[model samples]
Target: MTVPFYMCCQYVDGKFCFVLHEWCAKLPLKVQHHVVHPAHTFFLLPKIPSKFFGVFNCNICKLPSNGFAYGCTMCGIYVDINCAFIPKEITHDAHPNHLLSKVKPLVKLTKRNCKACNYPMRFRWGYDCTSCDFYIHLDCALFLPRVTKHKCDEHTLSLRYEPAENHISEYFCEVCEDEFSPWKWFYHCTRCAQSMHTTCVPLILQCEKSRMTYDSGGVYNFLNVKFGGTLEIKGHSHHLTFVQGLESDGRCIKRRYVLELSMIFKCLEFALMDQIDHFDHHHPPSLVHLQQPSNKSEEDDDEDEEKDEDADNFVEEEHHGGKCNMCNEQIWSFHLSYYHCESCL
Candidate 1:
């Protein structure tokens, strides 16, 4: 049998025990030695294909793992390679004074949320400062990148760890169109007025290379063809031309229509419009308008607003009379009404 060069193991009492190679020597000493978690002596263990173990989830992040892990056989405690090397302490721009200590929430009485991102930390491992009620996710504490570029936008985006203190309303990601807490980290392009969630930024930069494979699903080919370009679909007769943000009739398409089309044809190679040339044709092909229908009434809008207000009130009542779940700040009457500290809500 030929053994993979990247894998190394030892025969311990008749059973195979995985061991870290020289590549793992570059990892932090704490993780390598298991000094922080004495009960669980960490070892590099690769995922086994057998059904005996069932599914293994990381104790720290609570996310399922099927890759290289640092684990202990005796206690059955395991953590993914990324979580194993998380720093013990971190200082974020949002909370600079006290070093946020990496900790697992011991109490389950109150719902805990990260102060930096305003995201719930019920089962995830994150950094916290008891003194200031400051908490943040391990990924957020690392401050992944300072700047990034995405194909969705023209200008480069700069990381904004926290919004300005004076700024009030919530911010929404331009790409996903989902609202994100202003207190959390995000990417912003000042010139283009584009803002995206830190999590969403990575998806924009994913490799555009097509995955070529033959399967029963008719030989899927993920194409990265650009707009206004011609591409051949499997069964389509005419070469499909990509046209975005506009109808074939030259009228501006609605934003919602573009978003809907993008979602529906995300992985498919069919074009939104088709252009064909025929010698016998007497006149040019009539352009089709790609307009989205909107029939929302004023009463419906008002009802929606009322429902949102009611939900906000209910949340406030649930967390009222207690400290802010995120920052640990005293939840005054006014603060309780908002369900967050002045810095974040």
Candidate 2:
């Protein structure tokens, strides 16, 4: 079952999908100085800018935003309206002059670690500095509220990015009683002399409204978005919006939390897929898949196959409605994110 709201923001279609809350729907169209990408202005969008990815995730918190999101359409960078306030440039005492830029790693590293937390960053969306070798997880770079409250402390706990000046050789979390990296950020209460790991901090939600909604009898949790309807493009008569991805998706968008390792894997898979059509000129020929609606007849398919010998190269399909060749598991491609290479085809 889904909760109801008085008003909500949907997408390009005039009808409501019940995703964005009323206040969040009213966010600014663009901002010049957000920390998520200080170098560029982000335009508030009804949906993600491109269709190369089956999912659209915020570069800041690295969570999927299926509704109203602010994005740099030119750079293909996006963020949830929920995380639009965090800054791109921060000055942390732990890593002073913390100027971070959103980055997508080129290849998979078996065991990579964040420069700040000494925690694994493999398959993660993270920030990096070009001037230096500094690398920090997007999760670590943000979500550490500057101040918080917990059961153990009477006073508000302040986040300390660096080791305290009067700290001993080693420190431990007062809440979990486990040792954590001093080089990473932690919450501390000065009056109570209490310390806590960033992960140990309980989620303190600011509002009852979550990024979910109800419509009809089923509960709809909007995660990553896949294109559905068609839009008329100027100077073009036929439909340009895609249908293969949408039909394969079957309208199932899975519910996911940010802390899961599967989230990072999904992020990485989409980042790789995005490279296929990152720019207008550099876009692969496969983009032609979207030029026509997916409801093609057998004659149309045979005709298309006759036109190009390399036509199959465009889809990179493993097997439609079958087990993935790489992971060897049943996959609902649209549920999270998946990479299907042509090797198994």
Candidate 3:
């Protein structure tokens, strides 16, 4: 059988390997000139025979390549299409001042860590700077797109190649609910405050997009019927009761029960605005209230705890000139009634 020109394999190390013929022909003149392997130039191989081929691996990525490879016949160096197409030099938003050049690490330091992902550099191909200690993995530098859309969120997420200085706190992926490494690339949606890992993007995209209905009457009915019961939210010690039609005083409530109810109402309002649909088919929306402890012993214990706390505060005020615990500011006579800092509270 006569093989098509695009399907023709190149002989290397007495073995045939596959390569994308069209991809090689479309390479820019600048990339073609900068040969990756020093001893010999690499050529595209159309296909690798299924049988009698010893284990062949790409020298750049150190991964096995069976199809579509760029290889050198004399030096016996091979690389997959993705690794072979790495640009000679790249200007990333993370490092704008100087362009990062693609270079192989010294044989002695073959296991240096990548600065971009903080992962060990097992791959032979990477972008780095000779002047500085900046080094990034080949996959990290080239695998992501600037903007991408996923069904998990409504807003388009932009890829953040580098960590922002202001984002010091650890970030979690909205899709996987796993902690994200600051050194690795992640997608962020500013409007929704959503961040996700590149690996989780495909899984999120596969999920069915949630469609919400915004009829006020329907929402009212849903809230009243389906979600009226008490809910146990994670992290909160108390059970919350969803309340309906509570009037807001337009100011923060000081009472604990009132405050909890107010917060739940605010969340419901926000959900209404966003037109979020509840998964429970049987329940309706309602207001949340904290269930009071029924046991008299527990209530007495609470009173004792409050008295002890008040006694400690009295001692602290006498010794420390009634300083605000949060801000460490001296309390004035007029403000002595308020124990907490107004802003902190």
The 10-residue segment of model 1 with minimum total lDDT is 212-221
Cα miss at 323, model 3 (Å)? 55
Can you give the TM-score per candidate against the true fold?
Answer: 0.46, 0.38, 0.44
The clash numbers for all candidates, in the given order, read 0, 2, 20
**Candidate 2: deviation at residue 298, Å?**
89
Please report the candidate that would top TM-score against the real structure: 1
- How far out, in Å, is residue 340 in model 2? 49
Encode model 3's per-residue lDDT on 85-161: one tens digit a residue: 66789987767789999877556446576665555554456788768767776655665567888877888888776
> What local distance difference test score does each model get?
0.52, 0.53, 0.52
lDDT tens readout by residue for model 1, 1-345: 133234345676675545445555455433445533666568766553341332356666654445567777666777767677777887767676878888775566146776545656655567888877666666555535678887778998987766734464878777556665666667888888778766556453223211111110111111111234345657656765543221112222333332211211222353443343223234333322222354889887787676754343333443434453333555443332321222221
Off by over 4 Å in 1: 1-37, 48-56, 73-75, 108-111, 164-167, 205-345
Off by over 4 Å in 2: 1-25, 28-60, 64-79, 82-93, 108-112, 120-122, 130-132, 165-170, 203-345
Where does model 3 exceed 4 Å of error? Answer: 1-41, 50-57, 63-67, 72-76, 107-112, 162-165, 204-345
Pairs with steric clashes in candidate 2: 35-87, 35-88
